[model samples]
Target: MISSPDDLLRLAPDAKSLEAGRRLFYSRRWRLVGGDGQWLWGEWVYGSGQRATESAVHLTAGHFVCNCRARERPCAHGLALVLMLKNDQERISVGQPPSWVRSVQYQADRQAKPKPLKDAEAADERQGERLALMGAGVEELELRLLDFARRGIADTLAQGPEPFLAAATHLADAKLPGPAGLLRRLARLGRDGTEADIARTLGDLYLFVRAWKNRRTLPPDRHAELLQFAGVNIRKEELLARPGLEDHWLVLGTAEGQEDRLRFRRTWLRGEKSRRFALVLDYAFGEMPFERSWPLAASFQGKAYYYPGSYPQRALLPSTTPGGRPYDGLVGYPSFVELRANYQKALAVNPWLYAYPVYLSAVTPTLASGQAGLADANGEVLPLHPEYDNFFSLLAISGGGTLAVFAEFDGYRLLPLSVVTEFGLVKG
Candidate 1:
């Protein structure tokens, strides 16, 4: 028989581990109906009104597995079952993970890869389209930006050390219409540009793009700090040392666009517990921002490392979609039928699914399926799972809250959308 509750508590004193287990337990309580030693199993009711059986697995390694949608190392249901087992020492027959678990796991592993999501490509395409929309003369410049973007993307996909320098050099001193025009011109530089030139241009470009996209979402100081990355390298360690912003910062949304002669990425960050304070990490071709995001949020009571060093720890409310695009700003929300029709029309025109899944902030609120939605600092509605919901593109939503889509860049490195946006370059 199991000892007291304190015994179980003593077994896992690591606060982060305990918190993770607790969070997992509460997140999906449905699967854990009850257990018996011979064959620990329970029925999991789904939104579709279907009941699926999931076996409780207690492994020799002390690992737990529950057959559910979450692919975490120890899924929420599994943790719940473990907690139950720990307290109720009755020897129960916990069966192997069910067939569905194997099936779901197989599907997840099949789709897992280091490829950029569809939105990355969609962002590239959208940048092209946006440039074309800016003016007719910008076409030639757009072609150039596209070239640079291709190379930079390639470098990112391979996880190369620093590919931005090569891509950035191609854009220096190029002139075009607005910010997007500049990026298009830069892209035309090809491999002939210098590394130093690329770094400087990228540095400045990151700040501009990030500031524009997230102007409404961040507080004044954070906005200023992100904007500063355009001309300076804000060390990650420096940001970590600063005070009053440590918690799980959720990845809200990603946007890609281009400024003149530069490509950009903007990754939005919102604190799940702290609220109020938000961050935008802007990345450009040559310069890289320090990785201060983790320390900036997780430090509390002078003790750093508040978050666990495990998967599926940090997350926040999903993002809502932005209101109407440039000319469509005045249009009312599209009806479901209309939206579906438009989505279908989009597919017919561009039949191939996005190289990577395109993620959008929800234009409307929805809880169905795997989509996530939350309001941006500016109060804009961002959609979380448009690619999965509308395009039927296979994807894997990670426990770390990163949305992974498969697309290859010619040479560009994977950059956070916030970094790209900060530079006022094209956002993808």
Candidate 2:
């Protein structure tokens, strides 16, 4: 299996794709060996609950397939095996294949006249164990995300740095610190208490305070990074400290990336001519499969607040806890800009505007188009427009309405609204 972290990050995570594969799973016992990234190689029991001690080689990746008669892509047996691996169950011990399995392998080998990959038959229970652990970790992180959404941003920030502080404190206690440590701590939190409880209990006391308090004053880059560490992305900022729009915004789509153990969602406003705004959210606990919750696509309107930081509307964590514990790492979310003229003007002047017209990048400026435009920027550009990339495009469309435009850049890149200014819209 392509175990490279980057490859694993890029694996597709559509549940529909896995649905058929899930059916193939049944009551059979499976032993998982190492795989190429998304691919899982293993052996399992087959046949009508007879528990055919005969081991069989199975391969599962974006989809599941077994060289058995079950015909189903991901037979019931496959689903059970995956579920077991996902739930942190026991690991499959490494050893020689049973006599029945060896005989089957011999026949297949004779027919194919091919040499098996070195150690291909060697069972690796550890890999299965890891996968199961990672699956659980991912599910936990997704649950937390939904919880955060329910709590709303104000309520989360209102906690005032305790969680962030605790995260920092936990970082300090460990001596041999690195990315793994940071990820481990996040994974621990994913399974345990609420974000609030975790913040108050874990790590150094003073360090947490410093990070919590200093977050208010940290530079944009620093603040944004800290927030990312907590698996949150920075979307928009309110440099003027204005309150966000208070309304129901629809949750559009959510996507997962192999590059970062993160997920993003889109939300749009609802109403007549309800303008679409792309808001990007992220997760960073561990190697869990992507999250899928369609009901989240409902039209929800919430206030969008602007904070003074480079990350637009994000926060940051400290390097150490209040108790002097060294800090771990964090995650980052990128902001979407139309690169249009009107948006540039708003960004430059810093005036208090209630709600203005803003359009996504692909949306044409015509009456036929449903997209909205924010404002005009310098010279002759429309300024701010939405531009979503493949990773985030789904987030733009939720419950029939669109929220944001996923861009083709890292979360840190900002699209200049000046790039999308319509010459006709500008008084040249």
Candidate 3:
């Protein structure tokens, strides 16, 4: 069966493309729209009025092909074709796919085929090439960091953001997106951030560079972690082949963020018995098939195959079965002191873990000294993220009592995400 227009719209590269697809879906720009049992297709009279764009989507395999000059995949022509098949199917004639439609399937099958030994060797070679590329990028970055140390941050940042941005672009070109992101963050930090914040960012970048330089001496898991931080991808198949940690996992919370053109959501889960934390990160690019979600406060019995690392936080949950609510409501640090200690412990394990999830049971929302914060039973204050403006709603939920809170701890402050009260879960 074909997916709905909304589902198809989820993959659109941008709202502009989605709107364009919706318009194309109903417009009279298409002719001979048809489908067999397995494929939905159409011929769109696109910009070059003489050359008709052949748009086709596989009914079962979710493959889409369009013979058009559009740079993006599953372009508007294909999206509109699917919408037509779903919302206006009678307009589509029934027939087997022609040669052009079958070509997409052939490419998909070739790409999906397993060439274990050869692919592994090829991947290793690619990793080697990228690492070499990273070496050149890292050398220039080391010099930048050296300048910060010698010239002083005040003196260096006074020179402005150009140097930092150029270094970031070079790292990106080197295929080291992870470090590239850190460099960009530094450039954005500029002179606006506090002395502590700037120092911490520089420290993290320095340690990461050190980790990269000594990656070969690192243990297998640590080495893998380093590569990932440097923007190297470790395929799911590689992680799934590893033994998994079976547990009754509780959904701690979810957070969303956008990077460049892609939007991503991170679901934080913790094992009921194993006590291990797992992060499930999913990304969506308009018109791409990255539809993954995990319900909040739901319990799932599953085996999580973690990305190999010293901390082993992010993981791949290949499958899950409903396991009911966790033994009780959200359980977390008894006090702010304990939360800080635990975060420090985590930092000891992975110094680069800038943002870590911290849960607090029975914390009351408080506003004092012009700061929004959370207070544990003893009245110890943990400041809520400055950007968070949901305190009024949280206060309404609290009604002058304690509420369970889940927040991301970034060394100095807590960015409250969601609250669990007697009524239910409320995301901030």
RMSD of each: 20.7, 22.0, 6.5
What TM-score, over all chains together, does every model reach? 0.23, 0.26, 0.78
Which of candidates 1 and 2 is the stronger one according to lDDT? 1
Tens-digit lDDT track for model 3 on 157-249?
Answer: 887878778888888898888877877777778845666777888888899888878877988877877877888777777788999999998
TM-score between candidate 3 and the true structure: 0.78
Clashes of each: 107, 107, 5
Candidates arranged by TM-score, highest first: 3, 2, 1
Rate residue 58 of model 1 by lDDT. Answer: 29
Q: Put down candidate 1 lDDT per residue, 99-212, tens digits, no spaces.
A: 544564465555554446975798678666643443332333345435545667445335432333333333222222234332433344324444544544444445345444
Worst 10 residues of 1 by lDDT: 305-314
- lDDT of model 3 at residue 317? 91
> Which of 2 and 3 is ahead in lDDT?
3
Q: Which ten residues in a row have the lowest lDDT in candidate 2?
A: 419-428
Clashing pairs in 3: 11-286, 11-287, 12-286, 12-287, 13-286
Question: TM-score of model 1 relative to the true fold?
Answer: 0.23
Question: How displaced is residue 265 in candidate 3, in Å?
Answer: 1.6
Candidate with the greatest lDDT versus the true structure: 3
- Choose 1 or 2, whichever is better by TM-score: 2
